[model samples]
Target: MSTADTTDNAVRELLLVMPRLVGRVKRLPLPEQLRSLDLAPRHLSMLSLLLLDGPLTVSQLAGMLGVAPTTVSLIVSDLSRKGVLVRREDDADRRRRIIDISPDSRPAIAQWLSPGARAWRHALAPLSPAQQRIFVDTLLRYEAAVSTPTRTAPRRG
Candidate 1:
């Protein structure tokens, strides 16, 4: 087979298995620290986003999580009560509340996230720096694409 054929086949195989891989990870048990605090698996995503993007308002987080602002507020309240997150009034807008991860919880979040970092590091070790960046950027782009909502027309009842 030609190189293009081989690449196409590889892409097809990845498309078929990627969802199952994500499903398996989703089904995995939450880290003990999170479980102890009664946070759901979705909280990990919330925590990661807060860690990366810094503090965000309820509306911002709700948009990111694809949920209602009230839902994000509830999650933020839970995390705040458990000391995993802090809710503060936005400086620019007192009416808006910004949610951020607690400083004390950073160590636990880092520890929980380290395994994935290690795995990615190991996988990318053989790649040149430029190739590694490209690969990582491509993955991020793919994630962004999939997370975007489709603009389908409303269906009839």
Candidate 2:
């Protein structure tokens, strides 16, 4: 088979598998404390960042998330009210508030998110660093492509 055919086959396989992968991840059980919060994808992303990278300020989160600081602040405020997150004064910069998963919620969040992390680690472990970079870059490109708005051609009768 030509390289084009091989690439098309790989894309077809991914198209078939991606939905099942997302569905399985979505079906993973949430912790009892988190069940009532109605957490969205945005919340999951924020929580994942905090869980993996430790605490960060709202501006830092905004930068990492590619969103405005006000957006991150709103999420932080909602999660804070739900007892899922804590905001503390940054020692180095007294005016800035550092956001983190509350001690009470940390273990539950970790337990909920760890399986995916472990699975990614297992999948990437055998890859060379350069291979890993390429894989990540490809995924980022895919995300960007999907996120871009597409214009449709006008139809004629």
The candidate scoring highest on TM-score is 2
Give the per-residue lDDT of model 1 (tens digit) for 1-157: 9999999998899899988878866665566776678666578778878876888888998899899998888888888889999988888989998888888887788767656656777989999999999998998898898899979999999
lDDT of each: 0.83, 0.96
Q: Which 10 consecutive positions of candidate 2 have the poorest summed lDDT?
A: 26-35
TM-score of every candidate = 0.60, 0.94
Q: Which stretches of candidate 1 lie over 4 Å from their true place?
A: 1-8, 15-32, 117-157
Count of steric clashes across candidates, in order: 0, 0
Pairs that clash in candidate 1: none
- Provide the lDDT at 65 for model 2: 93
**Residue 50 displacement in candidate 1 (angstroms):** 0.8
